[model samples]
Target: MGAKLSGGGGSKFHVEANSEINVTPFVDVMLVLLIIFMVAAPLATVSVEVKLPPAIAKPIANPPKPVYISLQKSGNVYVGNELSSLDTLGDDLKKAIGARNPDEERIFIRCDKGTRYAEFMKVMNKLQDNGFYSVALQGEDDAK
Candidate 1:
């Protein structure tokens, strides 16, 4: 026999074991992160603004591979077809570029693959100390 007798009131909770997961908090967090990044993106970008000098685009039929400055295998300097001393290189570069374009905006440095790092830096100092900003390092590597 089954007998039922009830006489008291108490708190109770009924939970469904098969209920779906709630993702509202996750979605809200992602939206907040997206908005934060949207606000921060523009503020993170910075640039060194300079008053650019006037220039003209001149067409070169051959381009001549630029006026190459080279560091010799014997740790010497060469510009164009002339051998120059380290003491005179900076002045010589200025003179060479002045003869062609006084306001030289670009330069190309071609160093031997076997050249020392010190030698390479010395060559860079020659360019940078004289106010040349645009420079390119050119070399070709063997196919792997």
Candidate 2:
């Protein structure tokens, strides 16, 4: 006979050759879990389809052109139809927004899906720093 270590901080593993293997209970539990997942996986998901109305957006009657900026995966910025550098975007957007009347329009930001979180936050911070209060986020509506 040999001495064995039990459960403790300084314990080590020891085994007796006569120790019977008990895999029946383990297999039983695994089978139950497999069956449970098989039954629950389908019912766990509920699907519903929603319909949306198709209509053109009514543009603001009398307002200034909205100051818009986007952060692309490549980190390119767009003010209008032209691309801009990040270094000058903040100043340029500030000046563009300032040129408009107070009640004319607001700034809008469009972020691409692949854009990094830090980059998006930096763009938002720049917009805020440029004194843009009414900032709108642009996104596509789910065509449900």
Candidate 3:
């Protein structure tokens, strides 16, 4: 019976199933992707050149300095470099602007970026109380 079973088929040596993962193919695929990215990286950047026309305009002779009211983040108010309080803001602004009519003269206001909305509103209220209706918020233009 043993002789018959041996002659019937299979190999003499025992073969076990392979449990370990094969990573050589995975490593090869990753390396190929890395090389492809390296070759394509330099082509992604683009540069363009532009030429702008010269600006030509006549200069004004002796323009009067505009009245500037500045509000600090610390809640301090200044009218033309002079420190002022909310209670006296109107008086101080009027003094700084001289004989100009408050209603007609444009008042420029510059508030610190971190200043509170309430504090800014208080300053505006003070200006309104003093009959100064013409108000302008000052800001830097980014399109230079």
Models 1 onward score TM values of: 0.49, 0.50, 0.55
Cα error of candidate 3 at position 75, Å = 0.3
lDDT (tens digit, per residue) of candidate 2 on 1-144: 333345445526544344556788899999999999999999978587678788789876876567778778888888765677667776677566675653445778898999998988887777666556577889989998
| Model 2: residue 95 alpha-carbon error in angstroms | 4.4
**Tens-place lDDT digits, model 3, residues 26-133:** 999999999999999988876666787787877778846799999999999999899999999989988987887778888899999999999999999999999989
- Candidate ordering by TM-score (highest first): 3, 2, 1
lDDT: which is higher, 2 or 3?
3
Each prediction's Cα RMSD? 12.7, 15.2, 12.5
Which candidate comes out best when scored by TM-score?
A: 3
Off by over 4 Å in 1: 1-65, 99-103, 141-144
Q: Which candidate comes out best when scored by lDDT? A: 3
Compute the lDDT for candidate 3.
0.86
lDDT of 1 by residue, 93-134 (tens): 777776555355577788777889998888888777777668
What does the lDDT read for residue 143 in candidate 2? 100
